[model samples]
Target: MAGTTGIIGGGIVGIALARALSARGEHVTVLEKEARLAQHQTGHNSGVVHAGLYYKPGSLKATLCAAGRVSIREFCEEKGLPYREVGKLVVAVDESELGALAEIERRSAENGVPDLARIDDPSRLREIEPHVAGVAAVHSPRTAVVDYASITEAMAQDVRMAGGSVRLGHEVTGIRSKNGRVHVTTPGSESVFDRLVVCAGLQSDVVARFVGVDASPKILPFRGEYWELAPERTDLVQGMIYPVPDPRFPFLGVHFTRGVYDNVHVGPNAVPALAREGYRWLSISPKDTWESLRWPGAWPLAKQHWRMGVDEISGSLFKPLYFQKARRFIPELKSSDLARKSGAGVRAQAWGRAGELLDDFAVDQVGPVTLLRNAPSPAATSSIAIAEYIIEHYLVKAAA
Candidate 1:
């Protein structure tokens, strides 16, 4: 395709953008490095459509998550996909974390999240989750779960239906803008477009540089490893079981998520990955490793959180340590209860040179190219709204 709005990356964000543009009668082409769509972060996420609980009120995450929850549900229903509004419980294991839980409720309410209730009665807590032990909890009934991979697939189909083309295994190697046109060179071929929108997840910064943007905020891959509960222990989780997360960190702590298929998943410890696509302990790519380690953003982050980093690395190496984190929520959970090891998902967490993690989704415009630098968690939940926002903010302005 020539002279189209080229979107780099075929994750949910890219697909949603293609679908939106195509629906508006704009020519769009999506270039995906992977052989299939949603193969990385979008496909491997915990699949929870977060209910704007943890984000600060009025932030992009809060606004988009609330709006995206509605959009995702509607899209799923219309497309005849499986989804469940099974709700979530943010439990406080001790008195110290009660304040954080209260803050979450406050933020949720301020963000217009409906059906939020505080569970304090032990009997009622037991009624909702038999094995969960907590002094108090915030019950968010709007927090739901679905298969994000399926949602992405459906979005790709919608894009194709709208006359957009999705090119798989087409790795974007270069991008440049000149003479009112953006040129994108892929592994197999070269294409030019009026404008380029990149949603290149783990490789976003590199793609941004190719288009001559500063791309200063580097993408740090944090491998979230999960463990499935044994068949017999699956009964321990009913809905989503979460611990009151640390306020300083972006990670939501190790929690229990009940999958759409009725199995319970316990884990996702945020450990730094040696490789950008590193899923296993031994999985490594030399380029990804060298780039990550040498980034200016990496050293300061390491200095600030070296202790936490060491702990996370230790947990990844030892089963007992990993299970111990889970035991904080469900005390009955044994090392043996951790059965199959689920595949790892790498989060593309962006950090600035000053060592501050980018808390909200970031979008930067360089000439005719709009690059999405940091769209981490809730990006999946907020994909559609983010697309709409991008269309209104960037594409329409470019057209004008």
Candidate 2:
């Protein structure tokens, strides 16, 4: 812990870790592949700071999200950044979804989600979200949103102030352990650090393989596409209107989000991306696609969730299908309200050989090289807390 630390990936989690370590007097350097930080998942997310709604009680997601919300809120206030506690309502659109909604409420309570309210009356649900349609809902008034990209940049500033270095365009090509030190090679640069932490986002497994690690828990990129609401129709949503996510899948079904900028968008229908960083359907990578197809878990995963995959793909290709799904939660929602395809973000979801989605935060160590194999979803919302968790559980042991 007293030595220099080199962090791979320049997303919020990696930046947060660098800041924490730097503040503790550890020499830190961040290597970002892109020209800037947060170019991938961090900058391309919904921006909603989660409030421990759907995660199981006592999970890292549940615990860290609770703590990280407060951390992010404080960070925003201290930096004079925009932080909106716009609240979130997980609605049960019909009687059938009530069971999953109830489970969410229970988990929220167990996770100590602040000021969680269960609304059974339709009128009460209307009071929370005027245009929303739902039989019952679980509302968390403390749920908030912030610009994670801005936060990551601010944290990088803190790292620099604390004598840390952030190097952009430093794509790690190879990694090896030499003489008890980790040597990371970029195209034109060869650098050794006392410790190296791989938070390499989409290329986590690829980087791990450089150190001769197992590729079992592979990254399966799933693209979440969003459609922006027309400016005149933004008022239809007050805060966030989410569906009772199917417990069978890790993805929370497509819902409405009133962003911090006050522009409401509906979307993020999860579909298999042809590339690790695949944003649009046309942005396909043949090698990435072939590797995914060749994975042992690929068949089992497809077999289990092929229907959901087809439905998601259908929504992705056709706007009308996507509109129908959105309109179910808001009766007044017009197909025309979805003005244009805003953008897409590919989530680097980790899956096992048996086709099991690694739902929790996962870490692996090969000597001084610590690979963050899986850090999805609330990883951004729980960034600072994740830094602390990683430091306490992994870094300290490695340093000693």
Candidate 3:
């Protein structure tokens, strides 16, 4: 496979790119460290197909997400997968939040979100979500839900059907560029590729450094913990209930999500992780922890967002507070409505040296290598469009 295109990471973005390349008659190979695909971020997210809300106008995230949602829905329909457009309500509980809600409406309109409406009548809002309490709300009727991990597996199958290999458990230990070829070394063997794309979510910066790229923006892992709604209280959330997000932070505040399978999930509070892959408070890695501390940006970022960070961690440590925060959206939801804590995912958010978290997706190319430097929240929603963007702008242009 010396002349093949190599892609690292088996998550949705990597697999989606592999499918796109193979569809174009290009020989592709995907290398994953895990034993199976979609074991991390792809499988652990809230599974909401964003309707292009909350992104800055004219940005890659805004454009790509707008296109990607349509692409995902089409793909799911073709593959006979579950794609439910149950809709979402971004609620504002008080007069103070109405301003933010209006801003979100403006951004959604700028991004071409279809059928978005501002619901000011509380009774009308209650008709959409019987239990949700908000003075005003932004109803996104097109916002849908799908199982991303299932979609990833389907994409992996397409890769194999197109004669490409999805090699699991193939951890990339080293990467070097020499004489116009990239050599990727593994535990048992090494393979050379004409071009390489790295989508190593948690270890993105570390992987980019293997090819001698600048490592200024380091990856800071933030764990998002969630709780499953009890079976009896699943009706508490009609579709998806979200709060008016704080402009200062990139994360959407804690809310209720009705998954494709009809299970309601309440949570995903963002908390600082002790390690890059740490999903729980007890899961610690000394090396990862030290690297975060050693970076110039980490301390300053902590200093800037310490209050929110402390609140998030406090929510994680105490279920009552977490329940209270979530209750803001659906005022009738009770502590007993939550079952045992569900799964958690670690976000590989990029932080620059200036202590600012990158708010958009970033891609960097070094000759034959394309590295995804920053891809968060909307990434899963934007994976397909991102693949098209990379191929049309980078791969196709390079070949020309």
Candidate 4:
């Protein structure tokens, strides 16, 4: 079939992009490797609609995240989807981290986050979350919680309603550009499109290579493992709670999050994954393992942050250690309070050849193909804005 635009990967970004193009009366087709949409990172996130916190000022993440929060809420309301403005707290447990907390507050303000207030008194903290302990914190009223899977599903519905086709289990093996048309080859057949947008999250590098792009900044999958709080201890957390993140690391610290269903979950320790889709310890892929091990960016990242890696791996294996990290915020936490393993999500973290983590979202255009390389954390919250950006910068400008 012929389409004006072909979107690879049916995660949040791909679905949103397809919907946006189709809404504009363009013929769009989405190719998804999995039978269902959002089967990867989109489905496995904490579902927090961030309030533009923790991102560097004047960066794409800050701009998209700030605008995406509003767009997501409006989209959810229009679609009658479930979402909540439960708010969030970034707590500083020790005096040493107060400066970091202040920096986060400054960044949030620069990003245009509204209704932010500082809470330093223990009494007010108790009123918000009686179980949480912190010497200082920043209260962001705009932080929200939502079901990302539902949002992606709604985007898919909109795509179909706009006369676009979503092809499931159609994985592209190769891509070539010729005569102003791009040809995409899958195992079953070949498809053609005027323009191609590659939103493959974990496999973005591989997808870019097929179209003859350099595919720099290889994706290093970092598995974030989570644990659910026991049902009896759900009241310990009133809303979303987070620890002040270390500036050196990209992953947010283990924090408390209340899902839209009112169930509280704790965790998401960042550890290197053995496979791109490895959700459990026993899950391993030799091809993925070898590729990751031999990547030019892997060893330098390890050398620079070996201590943090060791700590994350230790926390992943030891329940007590995991509880200790959580206890910094909620002093009442106990090892027994943690329930059995729930599930894990692998973050598609991008590492440059120089061993530095890419702090902002990365997109590249070569000829007629556009590859969205690194889109992690805020991508879910920033889907709508990202879609518009892609349409403007990649589709329209590239065509011009």
Poorest stretch of ten by lDDT in candidate 4 = 246-255
Which portions of model 3 show Cα errors greater than 4 Å? Answer: 1-3
| Model 2: residue 391 alpha-carbon error in angstroms | 0.8
lDDT of 1 at 203: 91
Provide TM-scores for the models: 0.97, 0.99, 0.98, 0.98
1-400: candidate 2 lDDT, tens digit per residue: 6777899999999999999999899999999999999999999999989988888788888888889989999999999999999999988888998888888888888999999999998889888899998889999998888899999999999999999999999999998888889899999999999889999888999889999999979999999999999999998999998888876564658778888889887878899999999899999999999999999999999999899899999998988998998999888989999999999889989999999898888889899988899999889999999999999999998777
What is candidate 4's lDDT per residue for 242-276, written digit by digit as tens? 99988656365888998888888887889988999
Lowest summed-lDDT stretch of 10 residues in model 3? 246-255
Model 3 agreement with the true structure over 351-370: per-residue lDDT tens digits: 99888888889999998899
- What's the lDDT of the predicted structure labeled candidate 4? 0.89
Q: All candidates' lDDT scores? A: 0.88, 0.90, 0.90, 0.89
Worst 10 residues of 2 by lDDT: 246-255
lDDT of 1 by residue, 1-400 (tens): 2357999999999998898888888899999999999999999889999988888788888898888989999999999998898789989988998888888878778998889999989788888888988899989887889999999999999889888899999999998778989889987799989999999999999888897778678898899999899989899899899888775574647879998888888878888888888999798888888987888878888898899998988887898888887888888878888998887899999988877898898899988899999999999999999999888888788777
Q: Assess the local accuracy of residue 72 in candidate 3 as a C-alpha lDDT between 0 and 100.
A: 97
Model 1 alpha-carbon miss at residue 75, Å: 0.4
Greater TM-score among 2 and 4 belongs to 2
